[model samples]
Target: MIGIDLGTTYSAVGVVESGFPILLANEEGRRVIPSAVWFGDGAVEVGEKALRRRGVSPVVTSVKRLMGRRPGEVDDFPLPLDEGDRVRVLGRTPEEVSAEILKELKRIAEWRLETEVRKAVITVPAYFNDAQRSATKRAGELAGLEVARIVNEPTAAALAYGLDKLGEKARVAVYDLGGGTFDLSVLEMRDGVFQVLATRGDTRLGGDDLDAALAGWCAEKAGAGAVDGRMIKEAERVKRALSADGEAVFRVPFVDGGESIEVAATRRDFEHLAAPFIERTIDCCRRAMHDAELSPADLDAVVLVGGSTRIPAVREAVSAFFDREPDLSQHPDEAIALGAAIQAGVLTGAVRKVVLLDVTPLSLGIETFGGLMNVLIPRNTTIPAKAGEMFTNAVAGQRSMSLRVLQGEREMARDNWRLGEFEVAFEPAEKGRARVGVQFRIDENGILEVLARDTATNRDTVLEIRDAAVDVDDEKVETMVSESVEHAFDDMAERVFTEARLKAEELLPAVEAVLSQGDGIVPEEEVAGIREAEATVREALDSGDANRLKAAVESLDKATEAVAARMVERAMEEALERRMGG
Candidate 1:
């Protein structure tokens, strides 16, 4: 059995070895894979190697956003390809692209374990809606793995933690903020069963926003001429560095008017730029707690995941809000992936004692008169939830009527996004006399299915919400399995080379940038204080101490809270201004 954490920024695979869940290293003997892919020359390359050529490789980093898009949804960019390329997306879909990445992860897992693995469990956000869940299932098929269950990320984290908790039941809050998404979940564990009380999150919000905000601040403070895409990317790395160090400084050399100016960024300044983003997460935490009908005081423990959780201020704010310090024993990046492997073990009957019962994130409803929305199933309802609503003909002798279904919280139909629509034709009848019953059901994975029947005609109509096919056929899965055995190459060597290159590209300048900004952001007396922290991080980054790098990142985050807070205020102001103007 194998488990996969298909995260927005990175992916990882793991399995139980010698009675302990150990993350299986990639072809490079490293555990994590960058959740990025490069498109070139009619081929798709994933993970670290794909991330290396981000700009040059026509990479797609946030395909998760497009998972359940409706017809005519605009793509961020034309996929990296020339006209007449053999891989035509118009004939394909986002699921296919995502599946390609999953295939790569599976290949790495099978290669490292030296085993034939045909089944696994995958983890996703607890708040993911039906369309998103269905899309994931399809991706699993495309990768040639039978997806036994789509476990929620937070629930999985709790399971991984609760496995050691034994028979005691505890109310736990899982705070997970990954590269591209954030989720807060409240769960209850009793007798080995993990039941989710509530889950809430902003699917579009995450650590990436903090990096962008901090980078923009760095540009403004140093007057770095103009901010470019690469500068923004650099700001992200710098912000990541600030999470572990108390104060940092570096010079960002760039061109302006035939001259070069070295722009500097400090950990303090970065935090000032990012404080508001952290606050946003706090707001989400509050909401999730409310939805669960519990207060922070009710939580037994707050478990953190995602790279962003390493920030000191994030920990402090969470601690302050909940009136207790968070438990930081788990590896933020590896916990979810490890939990996924455990779930996989459960699915394969290697571990048979656990079951996960999760819930949907939003209400499912239909549009009614005056653009009002009538919800059939409210958000946070346990899955596999089911509800039925009756329909009638509005006009005499009307034979058919259209049903528009939406998924969201708004009262107005226009405000809520339409998941899909179906038309039910009824037998000819007196106007307003025909009775039709429509049943909406959400499965464990959160995928929606609708069935309608005309009572007068005794005819049944069913609609399966349609999406692009990433689901593979039997023949394709067989072929992929064969390719796995026949194609032999050095996967680890390739992964290591890619990770080392990316690390080198991201870190060296990161340390120096922190040093350069020290003079401007801290007092003269504090210079040595900042330098000492910087020195420790420099040694760790140089020595390749993952823990040290991780610590340095958090220390920097604490020193820079004021800056991140200011950025948060600015973001909130801009949002308010936009709403006011509208």
Candidate 2:
């Protein structure tokens, strides 16, 4: 089995041999493969070939950022597709585009091993939600390889670090800042067991952002219209140069009308521009520590992962934050892939006496009454874990129940990301009579599987939570929170009205559906009262009055109280009958 790090900007493959993980070079003998794909001349190219044609062809880099995110979820990014839609990169989805990179890695592994490579363990960001994890696995399948596991990057790094220190017990923090993502994971390793405590990161913040910032600074100095891929490449080189030297000069020849632009940039200047991005990673680290319920002082050692950690400024900041020198025992680029190889070894029984216990990055739940989120599985819960809730209908003769599965840390269902909605069909029992057990299981790969079992029939139905539209506005959370506080007075009335209108909209359909189900069961006078309340609500909705709509909704609720109770009673009776019959 081969281990692959399907990274955002670059990827690497490795395998275990003789109880040690060994990195495999590509056909060019290069250890790293640029995560780029190019389509031109009726041919597809990956890695360096695709990267070289970036400015000319329709080359797609950082396609990993688009993984698991819907079309409209990403904004301000230069993409070939429109918002809320998918664009075919040579008739391939983003997953398929990623699969091309995986296929390249598979080929490399096969060539080196002199055997077929069919199974592998892949690593993703620790904070990747359910959708991203699923998409990553799908990409592997499309590449004609069975993904044995979806390991977390930082967790994998921890594995690599702790592999030799199996007998030692320690609390370690893994700070991973890669090309297009940043993750901070806190783990406790003891007796060869690596247990992750907490993980947090910004999928959109990474070395790519810093490169863009430096490129923009260089472009402004050069008086160019915009920074192109070539200029950005130069900016990256200058960034690396400044890490060792006090200053570096970035020169672009013939940028405009046979004129060259040169700018001498100092380390201080690069640090100044990179300060905000670096601070963001630090903030994520602090949050992860907080969630893990430990301070920096509590950490035994802080291990740095990702090539971005090579920057001197990043190391200084990390040192300052943790009050100690960051451990650089492992190579930033190869640690994760190496750890993945170790995992593959364990899975194949080639390596012995090691185990990894990962955790879900976000909370999983369903919407309850009043739009509140009822969490079934809290964030950071150990993987290969299961949590279940028993649900029943509110009225008699209800055939099915619909539940919207969500993933996020938000308190409200609407604020969190909707994984998907599923329906559990029952055998036409009274409300509250059918016994349906809904279980959510997160496997070792951090992917979620929901199952609904009918207790009476002893039948189970597996639900496929497909096409999850995750809200991945990584940079907007703080801005939105601050704006909500500062402008709360200004938008209070509009916000109230909007919320009330939404309630009215929700109540209208629910009222109609309940009435349709209990038409003959409900008293005629009570039905008339419910109809009047519904009409009042409609009028209030049209009048654009928040108070009126709220009052109307309350009235409708009061009018249908007896009917709702009777529906529940009928359901309970049906349930009793079914149990007795069985």
Best model per TM-score? 2
Cα lDDT tens digits, model 2, 379-474, are 789988999999777568888778888876555567666777877777888757888888999899988898888888888888786654455564
Provide the clashing-pair count of each candidate structure.
37, 8
- What is the alpha-carbon lDDT of model 1 when measured against the actual structure? 0.71
> Which runs of model 2 end up more than 4 angstroms from their true locations?
76-79, 82-87, 256-258, 427-431, 469-471, 474-582
* Candidate 1 per-residue C-alpha lDDT over 278-368 given as tens digits, one digit per residue, 9 for 90 to 100: 7777877887787899988888999988888988778888898888988887888889888888887776666656777888777788876
Go through the candidates in order and give each one's C-alpha lDDT.
0.71, 0.83
Clashing pairs in 2: 71-84, 72-84, 395-431, 396-430, 396-431, 397-430, 430-571, 431-571
